[model samples]
Target: MKAFLDILKPNQLIYPNTVGYDWNQVDVNRPQGHPYYHWLQTNQGEGVVNIDNKSIILSKNDGILITPFTPHKYQSDQFWTTNFITICGYASIFFQKQLGEKKYFVLRESSCVDKDIYNLTNKLDSSCDDAQISLQTYKIFLDILHGVQQVSAEGYKSIPICWEIKNYIDDNYMEKISIKKIGRLFNISPQYIIKVFKQAFNISPYRYLTKKRISEAEKLLISNKDLLISEVANLVGFDGASHFIDVFKRVENCTPLEFRLIYYQGADFNHE
Candidate 1:
C-alpha cells in the first residue's frame, strides 16, 4: 500500500498551521494519541477510533475531527485506507471553541466536499515545484477546515422539506422539474419555496436543479465513453444539446467533449 505524509511549512496568515498529513493503509493496533488537532476519515474498510477513551467504530465514508490535546487512537481489523491531518495554531483555538468541550465529532457522508478534498490532495501531491505544493497544501487545509465547520454545524438535524426537494431532484434529475411543480407537490407556494430553500442551502431551487443536471451529464459523458453530447444532455433533462453545452461550459469551464477527452484520453465520438 502506498502512503503519503507531508509536513507543511509555516504560514504567517493562516493559524493554526497544518503540521502534516497522512494518507495510507493502517496496520498498527495502537493509540494515535497526539497533541495537535486531527481530522481523520476512513476512505475504505472499517476501523475503531478511541477518542477520550470512547471507542467509536468507523466505516467507509465515516470521519471524526478531534481537538488538540485529545486522547485518541485508531486501529483496524481488516484493510483500512485512511486520510488524516494534524493542525495547530490560532485557528485551532477558534475550532476548539466552535467544537466545544466534547472535542470529537463524527462527520456525515459529504461526498461532494470529500471529492473536493481528494482533488486538492491530488493537485498537491502531483506538483513538483515547492512553491506550488505549499500553496496547494494550504488551500487543501483551508478547504478541510471550512468543510469541518459546515459539517459540525449541520450535525444530525431533521430533514427539511428543501432537502427533500433536493433529494427528489437528485434522484430524478433526468426529468424536467419546476419550482411550481415542486411547490404543488409539497403543498407550498413557489415564492415560499424559493425563499426558504435559498436561506437553507444558499442557492435558489432552480439553480440547484441546473447544477444537479449538469453534474449528472458530466458523469454520463465520462462513464458511457461513446455517448454523444446531445444524448447526454437529453439524458440529464436539458432542453437541447446546445443549451446543455452552454451550461456545461459555464459550470465546468469546459465543453462536454473536452471534459470527456480530458478524463478518457483517446475516445471516439458520435454526434447525436
Candidate 2:
C-alpha cells in the first residue's frame, strides 16, 4: 500500500533568475525536481500541474502557494503566457515550517485580488540588477508569507464533501453524471448535495463536472491539435462544442480559440 506519507519531500530551489524570465517563457522537456514558492498569476493558457499523482489544471487568474518538498510540474497546452514573482531561496522555509512534510495545500482562488498579484509581479520584472531584484523579491516573499499566515488564521480546511464530490465527478465525468444521481449515491437529498457542495467547493456538481471534462478536452486539443473541437468535447464527455465552449469560457475567461492562440505561441509541455 502506498501511504500518502510515502512521497519524498520536494527538494527546494531558489533560482534568483530563472531561465527566460522576460516574456514569461519556459523550456519544455526540462523536468525540474526542486519545489518552489511564487506569487504566480497567468492568463490566456491552460495546463496541468501534477502533485502527488493528482493533476490540477491551473485556472485563469488563479494564484497558487505551493508548499515545499512536493514533487510538482507545470506544462502549458499552447502559447502560454504567465507573469509571476518567484522567490525560491529561503522561501520554502516558511511553507516548510507551516506544513512540515505535507505535500499539498489547496489555496482558494477567491482569497486574493488580481490587481495586487499583478502589481507585485510587475515590480519584480522591472528590477535593474541582482541586488535590487533580490530586495524586491524578498519584499514580495514576505508579502506571500504574510498572506499565508492570514489564510492559516482563517483555519480553512478542505471540506471533506469537496473532496468526495470532486472524486465522484472526476471518476464519472464521461458519463451523464447528474446531481440527483450523485445525491442517491451519497444517500443524501439532491438539494443537500447541491447546496453543501457549492458552499464547500464554490462550484456546483454540474459545474465541477464541466470543468474537469473541459480540462481533459484541453489536453486533447494540445496533444492532438488535429482533432476538431467538437471531437475533443465528445472525447471528454460533452455532447457538443457549443456546450463545451459556454462552460470553458466561463472558467477560462476566454473562448477556446483565444486560449489556443495565446498558449500555443510559447507553449511548454511536460507530463508525469
Candidate 3:
C-alpha cells in the first residue's frame, strides 16, 4: 500500500483569516464593504443583504460570498443567528478564478454555520500554532468551495450525496465495504461514487475505510492492553496480522507493534 500522505495533494493554499459561528445576527451598515472575501451564512431565523440595487432575503441554508470591497450592508429583521468567515491566503487568486464573475454568490444548501465548523472554532485555543490553525482553516475553506461548486453544477435542489456515503462509511467502517455496494445502496453509479467521494473527502472509499479501520485499531491497541495483534486486526476487519501490519505501516509510518510500544514507553523519553 502507498503511504497515506501520497494520496493527499499539496497543502491547500487558501485559508480563513477569521471565523465566527453562532453569533446573534445584526445589522451591518458598511456602505463601503470591508476588505477580504467574507462568507456569511444563517444558522437560524432570517436575514437580508442589500447589494447593487436589491435586498436579497436569505433563509436557512442560504449563504453569500461577498467579494472584497463590494459596497453592501446586511440586517437581521428578527432574532437571527449567523456564522461568518473572512478568508485570505496565497490561493486567493485561484479562489477568484473558481468564483468567476459573480460579485457575490447566493450559495444554496450552504449552511456554513453547521455544528462541525462551530465545534472546531470553539475548540481552537491559544496553544494552536499558525500552521495548525491554517491547516484547519484551509479545510473549512475547501468545504465551502466544494458545497458552492456542487450547487453550481447540480442546481439548488440537488441533495448532498457525498455526505450520505460518508455517514455510511463512518457507521460501517468495521465491516467490509465495496464501492459497488455503496453505489447500489445510495442509488448512484460506481464512477460517480468515486468522483463525489474524492471531491468531498479527497480520497476514495477503500482508502477511507482503511484509514478508519486503522484509526479504530489504534484505539483498540491502546485501550485493550492484552489484545493480541491478530485480535486487533480481526476486530478492525483486517484479514490477517501481516496485511494489517503492512497497511498500518503505510498509513502511520510504523508497525502496529511499534506504535503500541512507543505509545506505552513514550514516558521513557521524558527520563532521557
Candidate 4:
C-alpha cells in the first residue's frame, strides 16, 4: 500500500517509467537550475550547458547523460536559441540498470536521432488514450536506455576526441573558431590537429563545426517560437533563411517550416 501511494504522486510515478520516452521543450527568461534524477539531453539548438566545472555547447548529434541531482544550468552563449529533452525519475534506473554506475553520459547530438525524435513526438501528440500513451512511452524509454548503453559499451570508440573538444565547442561555437584556431590555442599544427582529432572523434573538424551550428539552429527554432526563422538562421551563422532551410532539410529530412510545425503543434510529451 505504501508503494502504491508512492506511485500516485505526480512527481514520482509520472517520471522514470512513463516519462523517459517523451520529450519536453522549454525556454526560460533567465537561467534555471534543478536537481534531477537520471536525464538524457540532446540539444536541438545553439546553447551551452554549464554544470560543475564543465561546459558543453550543444551541437547536432550530441547527446548528454546527466546523473540524478547534479545541479546544472544552460545559457544561450549568444542570442542563439536552445532546445532539448530531459527524462527523469525511476525511468533513469533503466539506464543505471544497463550501464552500471556512471555519474553522467553525454552524446554529441546526432542527425540520426532527428527522425526518431520527430516520430516519437508525433506519437506523443496523438490524442490517443492515456493507457496507450503510457505503454508506448515505456517502450520508447527502453529504446532510449538501449541507445545510451550502446554508446557506453562502445567506449572511446565512439567519442575519441578529448572531452576538451566538447568543452571548447561549448565555450567557443558562437565565436569564429576554426581548426587552425583550435590548433593554435592548443599549440599544435593544423595537420596534426586534423589527424589526432579525427582519430579521436571519428569525424573531421569541419563536420564537427557544421553539426554544432545546425544543432544550435534547431534549438532556437523550437524554443523561441516568437523569433523569426530568418533570425534563427542568422544567429547560427547561416547566410540567409533559404540556406538554413536547405541545410536543415537535407540533414533532418524536413523543411524548417515542417520541423517547426511538428515541434510546436505536436502533443505535449509527458513522462509517466
- Candidate 1 has its poorest 10 consecutive residues by lDDT at 12-21
lDDT of 2 at 147: 51
CA lDDT of 97 in candidate 1? 31
Residues 1-272 of candidate 2: C-alpha lDDT, one tens digit per residue: 00011212122212233311213434332144344553444454655566677776656655455553445677776665544543453223334543335554444452343444344345445645433344444444444544554454343244566567667887878877788888788888888888877765555777667766865665565455477878877788877889888877766555565445433443222211
lDDT, candidate 4, 125-195, per-residue tens? 56454333333344444455446644643655554444566568656666677887887787768897677
TM-score of 4: 0.43
lDDT of 3 by residue, 164-267 (tens): 88779879887778998998898889998898777765568788789779867866775666899999999998989999999987776667886666444432
The candidate that wins on lDDT is 3
All candidates' TM-scores?
0.50, 0.43, 0.51, 0.43
Candidate 2 residue 85 C-alpha distance from true site, Å: 8.2
Which tens-of-lDDT digit does each residue in 1-272 have in candidate 1?
22344454343212223322235555434354556766677777888887666788877767777766666678877877776655542223334433446667677564443554465456555754543443344444545544564564363235477677777877888888898889888999999889877766666888878876875675576457778888898999999999999987776556787666744443333322
Q: Which ten contiguous residues of candidate 4 have the minimum total lDDT?
A: 1-10
Question: Which ten residues in a row are the worst by lDDT in model 2?
Answer: 1-10
- Cα error, residue 247 of model 1, in Å, equals 0.7
List candidate 4 segments past 4 Å from native: 1-17, 20-161, 266-272
lDDT of 3: 0.69
The order by descending lDDT is 3, 1, 4, 2
Candidate lDDT values, in order: 0.62, 0.53, 0.69, 0.53
lDDT agreement of model 4 with the native: 0.53
